[model samples]
Target: MTRIGIVSRQQESDLARIPHVVRLVEDAGGTVVAESELRTADVVLVLGGDGTILRAAEGVRGTDIPVIGVNFGHVGFLAEADPESLADVVARLVVRDFTVETRMTLAVRVTQPDGSVETGWALNELALEKVERARMVDLTIGVDDHPISSYSCDALVVSTPTGSTAYAFSAGGPVVWPNVEAILIVPIAAHALFARPLVVGPDSTITVVMNEMGFVDGELWCDGRRRLAAPVGSHIEITHAEEPVHLARLWTSPFSGRLVAKFKLPVRSWRHQERP
Candidate 1:
């Protein structure tokens, strides 16, 4: 019997549906196990939406256990299967029938004046943002320990290609395909002349220095879950992590297809317009 682990949104949005999911797995000849015993689990089923998937990403971060998402939220971009396909998904999960796609992750380190180092990791992004509204935080951006520029901005989002579709995209960053290995830095509402989003090589390291003289201190959030404080003169370092998040892909469709379907993008070409 395959040992299966299940993770759900903390909001417990679909509490009523969990038992049904369990029954499906049970009927499919799989045993539901606790995430604490993740080492023994063959694969993990993540329930809920993209946010829930992000929350579950941390649990198996440095492990080989792959995650398969079931769409139970508004936008289920990260999910491989929908509620209507639950029975089929459960049957597949029983036999571990899926391909694992490796997605790059990021590791963040926060250095305080007291010489204390705090670390976090995320599958989406490492965001350094002002704690208060209507206030911009001052930050000095750099690559490989070399300073690039200083600016007062609402936030600085450092994301992997896999994250380009999440917060980074909403903040005016380009949507990079998940298979692309790169880093994107988008300065949110920046007050600088050259505030365009930057794409960096996968091996490059990024540093963000927060200005203590600014009106508000900043907070560092890893995938919107783990958090660390960034006070004045705090230095934050970001780099591609050794560990990658594995996603169990049921369909071999191109990522572009998922993008168009999820966003309901208009595909009508102007060249195909009927001439009057």
Candidate 2:
């Protein structure tokens, strides 16, 4: 029997239904466990939204265990399966019917000009924005030691392919396929017309340096979890992480289809437009 770890957020929006899902897993002849009760588990079952899954990712970081998410909240991006399909998902897990998608993560390091450093990792994207005012942040961007451009902007986002649809997309970045091995740089409300989004190879290193003596200090946010106050003259270096997050998807679904269904995108139909 395989040991399965169950993880959830504090909100527990579906707290009443956890026991039912646990029973289903137990009936399948697998040992059900929680993060606190984890013990060499083969799989980690997450119950909640993307935030829950992210937390679970951090908890299982550096481990080889695969994580399966059952969506029980709104906008279940990472959590593909719904609560109603918990039994079906569990059954699939019982027989090892699943596909593991390795998602690229971002390893960010914040270094002061004096050489002090702070490090964090993000599955989605890292953001640098002003704290109080809506003023544009003056900064210089670099790629692999080469100077790219310096611009004033409300914020900047360094997103991975897995994070293309996140804040990066909303900020006018391209929707890169999850399997695409690339890094995305999106400027949020850039004041300069030439400041456009750029998609670069995953192997490249990206950096954003804050111009000291600016109007205000900026802030750096990682996966909306870890935070660091960006004092002036701080260097924010971002690169593809050596480790990837293993997501266990029970079913095979096309990315385009999921995007359309999730966003209710309008599709033009020739049949409906033409009268018979």
Candidate 3:
């Protein structure tokens, strides 16, 4: 029997609904497990919003198991099915009828004073922002040992192609296809006139060196979940991770359609807006 692991956020109702889903999986000749008891599993099922999926991915990283997300909350970008459609989703899974997509992740390392270092990784973006007030922070950026830009801004976002449509897009970055082999650097509310987004090769190394500002420093947020207070003069290093997150996609929904559906975008073409 194949083993399936289920991970959920703090939502007690999602946890409550697991038994029904587990019964569905068990009826199809599979065993269900939880992350705590999951030493080895064939696949993982994530329940909650995008944040929950991100957290669950971290737990399953370095493993070959693919993740299928079930939407229990709003804005579930990673979920494959809604709560009401979980039975059909499990039926599809039982027949091994799904495609898995490998998504690149970013690994970040921060060099602190006295030669100390801190490290983390993010599936969406690694953002550096001003602390306390929204004062502009001075920063110098470099890519693969080459100087890129020097600017003062409220924040800076380093993102992967999978993250291009997330925070980076809101920061005026381009929406890159998920399979694109590139990285994005976007400046937030920058003072420099030339602070436009740049897409670099996947192997390139990106760094952000913060300059000293009055008594205020800045903060670093990973995937908008993990937070770290960064002192002035700290340097952040970002690079593509050696491992990628494998997501089980049961449908071929194009990224364009997802964007339109998620954002409720306006249709400009008369054909789309008008009856045939």
Candidate 4:
């Protein structure tokens, strides 16, 4: 029998739906397990929005545990299935009838000026944003030991292709498909002309140095969930993680289809005339 691990959004309404979801999985001859018992499970079912799925990803990092997400919140871009398809989702889980797709992740390391260091990972994008709004954070960015440019900016969004459509996109970065193996760098509200969205190879290491003379410090946000203080003269580095996030999918649609569906992009052309 297959074991299904469950992780929910934890909202009152989302929690209420778990009973029905568990019942469906049980009826399909699957056993439900806690997120902590993932070692014994074949797959994990996340019942929430993208944020919940990202949280689950963090737990299963460095493991090949495939996570299947059911959308229960607004703009569930990371969710592979909808809440209405709970029965199908359960059936697929019991039979192990799904494809596991790997998405690239970023391993982030922060070295404070005081010689302290911290390391973390992000499933989406890891952002470095201003801690104080009074002044912009001064940053000097580079790639693979080669200097690129330096300037003051509101934030610097370092993202994987899986994250390009997220904060990177909102920051005027290009929407790179998830399959593309690259690290995307986008400077947010940069005060310099040389700062622009950049795409580097997956093996590249991105480095950012916070200028010591800056008026305020910056904060390092991992998927907008985890945080670390980035003081002046701090050095931050990002690279493709060794372990990628695994996502189980029942749908065979291409990334363009997913993008169109998620953004609700109109495909109808001017040639399609409405009957008068």
Give the per-residue lDDT digits (tens) of candidate 1, residues 1-276. 988888876665576677888899999999987667765788888888988888677777788988889988877888998888888988898998889999999989999878999998888898898889888899889998799999999899999998898899999999999989999999999999999999999999999988777778889999888889987789899999989999988889999889999889998754755789
Report each candidate's C-alpha RMSD, comma-separated, in the order given. Answer: 3.2, 3.4, 3.1, 3.4
Best by TM-score: 4
lDDT, candidate 2, 150-264, per-residue tens: 8888999999987888889889999988988999999988877689999988999998899985676788998888898787789988999998888998778898877887678
- Candidate lDDT scores, in order, read 0.88, 0.84, 0.84, 0.91
For model 3 the local lDDT of residue 14 reads: 73
Could you tell me which residue pairs clash in candidate 4?
Answer: none
Error of 4 at 112 (Å): 0.7
As a TM-score, model 1 comes out at 0.94
Using TM-score as the measure, what is the rank order of every candidate, best first? 4, 1, 2, 3
lDDT score, candidate 2: 0.84
lDDT of 3 by residue, 16-128 (tens): 88788889989988888888854477788887878888877887888777888888878786677888888888877777678999999999988865567888888889999
- In model 1, what lDDT does residue 179 have? 86
**Model 3 clash tally, residue pairs:** 0
Shift of residue 148 alpha carbon in model 4, Å: 0.6
Lowest summed lDDT across 10 adjacent residues in model 2 is found at 267-276
Off by over 4 Å in 1: 11-13, 270-276
Instruction: State residue 70's C-alpha deviation in candidate 3, in Å.
Output: 1.7
